[model samples]
Target: MTRTDELIALEDKYGAHNYHPLPVVLEKGDGVFVWDVEGKKYYDFLSAYSAVNQGHCHPHLVETMTKQAQKLTLTSRAFYNAELGKFDKFMSEYFAFDKVLPMNSGAEAVETALKLCRKWGHEVKGVNPAAGKIIVCDQNFHGRTTTIISFSSDPDAKDGYGPYTPGFEVIPYNDLAALKNALKDEEVIGFMVEPIQGEAGVMVPDADYIPKAAQMCKDANVLFIADEVQTGIARTGSLLAVCGNCSCENKCERQESYTRPDILILGKALSGGMYPVSAVLADDDIMLTIRPGQHGSTFGGNPVAAQVAIAALEVVSDENLAQNARKLGEMFRSEMQRIIDSSDLVTKVRGKGLLNAIVINDTPDSKTAWNICVKLAENGLLAKPTHGNIIRFAPPLVMTEEQLMDCVSIIEKTLSEF
Candidate 1:
């Protein structure tokens, strides 16, 4: 059997049948490209769900990982490590947060935010300990954790996962009236949402949605938690999508006008897709609610993860990836719009920065996006459908203008064939 067939057979025999991965088995990657087991190359358009914003196997990140691994990998939460403090300082300063709590995954960071909100609700906000409620948006994708799923509006994500955790109320994404109604109960403690719903096909809300929601939360004394796992760290042009504009040469103004979140949850690109490193950032009062025994993780703040994350953040800033993503994303969307205008199969193209999507007019059950993705694979670009009818296109931030144009040509060719 071929290596691909052997690998598939091994997975079928030994691995859990949880994920329905694409047929391609990637054996190597560099920048925005990946090589399959058979050596066919494809542009990595999805960037591992926007995790590898710095690109696949970034040299700096790899060097940091190697050097850190040679020095120290783990020391557990039982004792302090040298790199952890440095990373904490770097992250806090970079994001302008007072403190940060390290975690292992995006879901863990979400969990940390939830816990922090709950604790702050009771301890700081003066809400009843068990009665505080957090408002979430419909069709939200926080993570796969049980509590996160409890508030999910997607039936498939929550079908068999119950009895779900309680205390979360779902509201419409862009409707301020719905949020006002929800918050009128006086028991609401926080508002947690992804600025742009990444997994929900890069759904960008109304321009004023985030700022208005934040204002409402502030007026109502509810914490505004921004889940920037996929949209943060320059993925959406700005360092955080909640920030209004992200012009490359206008960093100072953008930073000055940046919308500061009460609670910030980060992951995925936190380590440039090299390692599982996530963090929750908040001020002293909000973060201090967690006592010594309240929360901890074994590998959350390990030295290796810290070093890797530092390099990842450095790559983002030094490479000015945010600017690159903005320029390239504009070109990509414009190209996609041209294709959509010509093709009857495509309905719409929307999103910001590198996080964008193409919508198919077919029913959600038709798997049209999946079929298009298969076609795209044949044309040498890689992307995955989010909800059967929508394909997200988020290439690594390291992609060049030429590479982006090449990818657009591939997408155009595939769509034409479709």
Candidate 2:
């Protein structure tokens, strides 16, 4: 058997079948490209679910990680590390949050945010400690954690997770009316949402959805929690998805459209896909609700993660990745629209910045999108289908205009086959 086939067989025999990943055994990656075990290169349109926003093995991140690894890796939170303090202070100021709670993964950061919100609700908002409620948008993809999947509308993710955690209300996404009504419930403590729903087919909300939702939460004393794990860090053309249309390279609170979340949960690209790094940010009033012993993780704030994240964030700013994503995203959507105008297979293309998706005209249960992705892979681009019929295309932000056009051409050619 070939090397690729042998590796695939090994995984099938040993690994859990939890993921149905694209049938490509990647061996190496750089920038927006990846090479499979067979040495064939392809554009990485998925960007490791937007974790490699700084591209694969960024030099700065690699250097930072190496240097820190040689010095110190973990201190288990039993004692403070120098890098952790620096990262905490840097991220707190960078994102304009008064405090930061570091974590190891997107799900952990999300869990941290949820815990923080609930504690704040009970201690500060006078809600019942055990019965505080949080509002979540339908079809949102925070992560696969049990508590996160508890409120999930997707059957695949939510099924068989018995006796699910309670205190969450699911509402239709982008429906301000529903959100407004949900916030009226005195039990609600926070409204947790994705600025752009990445897993649910790159669903971008209405232009005024976030700002209005934040205002509504404010009126009801409910915290607006932005789960930006997948959409943040210049993926959607801004430093944070909550920045809205602001074109600034840094913190964009000055923008009129900025919907500053009371608590911001970030992950994925925080370490530039070099390591697992995530964080929950909030003002002191909400963050201080969780005392020293309430919540912690052993490897959350390791020196390696801290330095890697610092390097990653620095890359985003230094290279102006957000601005590049903005300009290229507009061009990308326009190109897709042109293709859609002529093709019957693609019904819609929707997204912002580097994170975008195209809906196949076929039914949700159909394999057309999957087939198209396979064809795109054969043609030197790698993308994946989400929710069956929608293909998410989120290339690394470091990609240039020439490379983007090449990928667009590959996409156009592949779609023409189906």
Candidate 3:
């Protein structure tokens, strides 16, 4: 009878049941909040998996998209578009990279990085041609592609998705010794990992792990690639988590603490959750190895994507979302810690910036996180469980202190009820 009911019915009738989305069907959003078709308001804690770092329907990004759409949307890679060059220049300058290769999704950027690394191994590093091996972290969440999933430790991601691709060696995350052991093989070309495993439930490694791992890779002539699709763009209160200080030099010491990736992969927030625009950034040698016809996407670097991305990056800088995320994230984590200390149901709360998670001691079959999320939905906050017993709470960076406190209160109230 209602619009929400009609939408659900239509989805059940026509859509494939791939994702188990929450019951609420959001019809509109602004900044940190979204409204459902039923006209109920809820704070969006997930931010579409850290894509809306600039917040939902950011005016700048929307304006850019609208203006660009009116002028031009697509012009295949065969011919250069006006916006693409400007966007590439802006991105290179913003990230301090020599060059960038654009793609459509986080997974595509990741795939591009993999290809680039392998090609660089053969062409520049002079490793055995076609024998390059990339060392990946165990419990990694790169993407859903066959090659990405082939190295996945999660059974659900890889099940029935064989025959798998090879040339990947899985090593335990944050363990410098294991990474050293994996790279001892002459065929090893690079170490690919998420600075913080986002989909693995906001898993942050040891403070010194990434820097040490990067040093080891550098010593072994292997590239250190950071897949920062979820952790980058101020999601972790840094422009790139590996970069430490995403927007300024005040945190130079902190920036130096983490290992900077040789090849940087970014997506999601790159377009401010407006459109899918991912990219691979590298210095000349690693990025240039891929010649024409090696790899590309038709919609990868379109005019619309270019304009949207430029606006998105601008919003991240102009709004100071990183600093906001840092301050609010600390407040959130502290509040959650207080709750965790008091509650017996929650085992721990862990994460950086707005990207956070709480572990439920209950069994997976209990769907504790799911039940909590349903309660959270009823309380006007939205979040989703990553795994069985872990719930990820990552709100957009544009949230105010009052909004964050309100969200914290909602969470506290919900947890108390549980």
Which prediction has the highest TM-score against the true structure? 2
Residue 144 CA displacement from its true place in model 3, Å: 0.6
* Candidate 3's TM-score: 0.97
Question: Between which residue pairs do clashes occur in model 1?
Answer: none
Q: Each model's C-alpha lDDT? A: 0.90, 0.93, 0.89
| Residue-level lDDT for 145 in candidate 2 | 93
Q: Taking the tens digit of each residue's C-alpha lDDT, what string does model 3 give over 95-128?
A: 8778999999998999999999999999888888
Residue-level lDDT of model 2, residues 1-418, one tens digit each, is 9999999999999999998987889999888889999999999999999999999988888888999999989889999888888999899889888999999999999999999999999999999988899999999888889999999999999999878999999999999999989988999999999999999999998899999999999999999999999999999998988898998744777776688999999999999999999999999999999997899999999899999999999999999999999999999999999999998989999999999999999999999899998899999999999999999999999999999999899998888777
Candidate 2 weakest lDDT stretch, 10 residues? 248-257
User: Model 3: residues >4 Å from true position, as ranges?
Assistant: 245-255
Q: Write the per-residue lDDT of candidate 1 for residues 272-372, one digit (tens) a residue.
A: 99999999999998999999989999999999999999899889889999988888888989999998888898899999999999899898889778988
Count of clashing residue pairs in every prediction? 0, 0, 2
Estimated TM-score per prediction? 0.98, 0.99, 0.97
- Evaluate model 1: give its TM-score: 0.98
Better of 2 and 3 by lDDT: 2
Cα shift from native, residue 216, model 3 (Å): 0.6
Error of model 2, residue 95, in angstroms? 0.5
- Name every residue pair that clashes in candidate 3: 45-394, 239-246
